[model samples]
Target: MGICDAPARAKVLNMSQHNGSFGCNYCKIYAPFNEDLKCRVFVPTSNLQPRTTDEWKKLALAASNTKITRANEREFLGVKGWNQLLRLPYIDIVSFCPPDYMHSQLLGTVRLLLAYWLGGRSQLFKYNFHMVWHLPQVVRQYGPLITNSAFQLENWMGKIAKQIHESKIHIAEQAINKCSVISSTITNFYSNIDCFETEFIKYF
Candidate 1:
């Protein structure tokens, strides 16, 4: 490399060298086999408040970080590209940000990704759809899109950042409800046991 410009693969560990790596030196970092990769999915459950540039940046960041984590998710889960998230009714792009500044960067980067996802990479290499006809052209539109709660941001997402948020309680409630069914059934059995015991006592 040049004296001024830094060399590629300059890290101490050279994460791109491992097998099963979708992460190439030129683009993706860290080998795909980096299995211990921790991932968190952050999707707002509701619409957001009015955004300043800063707030909008945070919104975008969540999605940006999610995209990176998704690579790991795809590898570990054996899924295809990010299209799966698109199909989910309430799932949005996700990311992990322990600190706020890191959060903001994700937002900023997501804004960049949204642009790329739209606009056809370069105009010469456009993403085209030859489907039902007139609607297909309209359906494929992309660009700045609303970052709604993962449950909300479905179907075609176009335009720039739209306020997307999510309900953690709703998700929690569903989780609780899902698991509690068995617990509730077990509880009922115990509760009815007391009644049965009293009836047997009376009979005896």
Candidate 2:
């Protein structure tokens, strides 16, 4: 599943744990599975029964008392919620959520670039620059380079936005016209390949 780290790992799993604690949702060595563990939002897979608010609060209280050692803190934090989710038959939660390159890489990079050009030594610029500096290390933890990036999607959408602005057409009609223009252009380009070759040969 694609999700940000703080919400998925920290708030969900390590509730009440010190913010600086190095905890996570996945490692068995750190947070071993226990049947006795409680969760505020427990959902039984078989019956799909929902726990009462009071029961959830009790679970949360119990979970808060569960001792987490510094060494295995990360694994222990989110066991309750993680285990509960695992019992559900339909949803197969992956061990790790893929880092969002769209937000963290492409848009992040653009933000950094903008900060460099426009921020003019402001604190916001400094913060963005710092993040940009650490981006490579952050990406390395996730996996290989992203094959597709937000840059392409954002750029295409930006062009569409510009077209909409220039055309001053109704939004719905602009969308239809844009698609029609693109399809017609592609068809015409392919159909005129022989003509293009003839012109190329004559020009040469």
Candidate 3:
């Protein structure tokens, strides 16, 4: 049920970011960076198996236990380390989360296609038009994305941004910590609502 952009998804899952090898969450797809294209290109493969939550935990644990640096990396099965979310048994740490449509589709594919078509690169982009090609499959897997897209959640960013001081040191950390505190406070208040009502009755 986590709806987030690519970077946030990587942070929450403690996995490789979108640009890294084996960065995909749904499948074990290795996307290597194409220097000429200036982006990671996913080589289509049919035999790759979809990632499972159990497998994700195992891989994450194995990656964390090792003294793996750059040279000895086994791609870590796309997992860098364990996340707090993994500790929750009811949560599906893999497959349940899908990439945000706003970032992945509107900002990414649409912008790219627009740039190509409007910027007079349409002929050149014909060979590089795989972005739109995957839409149907993505829709099939995740359902109609407009409902769960990041559009609604992103509205809070403007308000949260205004809270930051001019110093701007650790801005993201400050925002996240503030959100966590707010969430904890709300949960605590609701959990103790009956006590509050009793105290209110006595006061009146």
Per-candidate Cα lDDT values, in order, are 0.27, 0.40, 0.66
For residues 24-43, write the lDDT of model 3, one tens digit per residue: 77777667667777767776
Which of candidates 1 and 3 reaches a greater TM-score? 3
Worst 10 residues of 2 by lDDT: 39-48
For model 2, what is the error of residue 201's alpha carbon versus the real structure, in angstroms, after optimal superposition?
37
Positional deviation of residue 19's Cα in model 1 after best superposition, in angstroms: 13
Highest lDDT against the true fold, candidate: 3
lDDT of 2 by residue, 12-89 (tens): 332422123212222211222233432121121223222233333344455556665555544433333323443445
> What are the RMSDs of all candidates, in order?
23.8, 16.1, 10.5
**Deviation in Å, model 3, residue 134 alpha carbon:** 7.7
Q: Estimate each model's TM-score.
A: 0.14, 0.28, 0.66
Ordering by TM-score: 3, 2, 1
Q: Per model, state how many residue pairs clash.
A: 23, 4, 0
Instruction: Kindly report which residue pairs in candidate 3 clash with one another.
Output: none
Better of 2 and 3 by TM-score: 3
Writing each residue's lDDT as its tens digit, candidate 1 over 1-204 gives 100011112221122211222222122222222233332112222232221223223433444445535435433221122232233344322211011111222333344456677974422111011001122222122111111111121211211112222556564555455555445544654455456555545754
Q: Which stretches of candidate 2 lie over 4 Å from their true place?
A: 1-98, 106-144, 166-168, 181-204
Which of candidates 1 and 3 is the stronger one according to lDDT? 3
Worst 10 residues of 3 by lDDT: 122-131
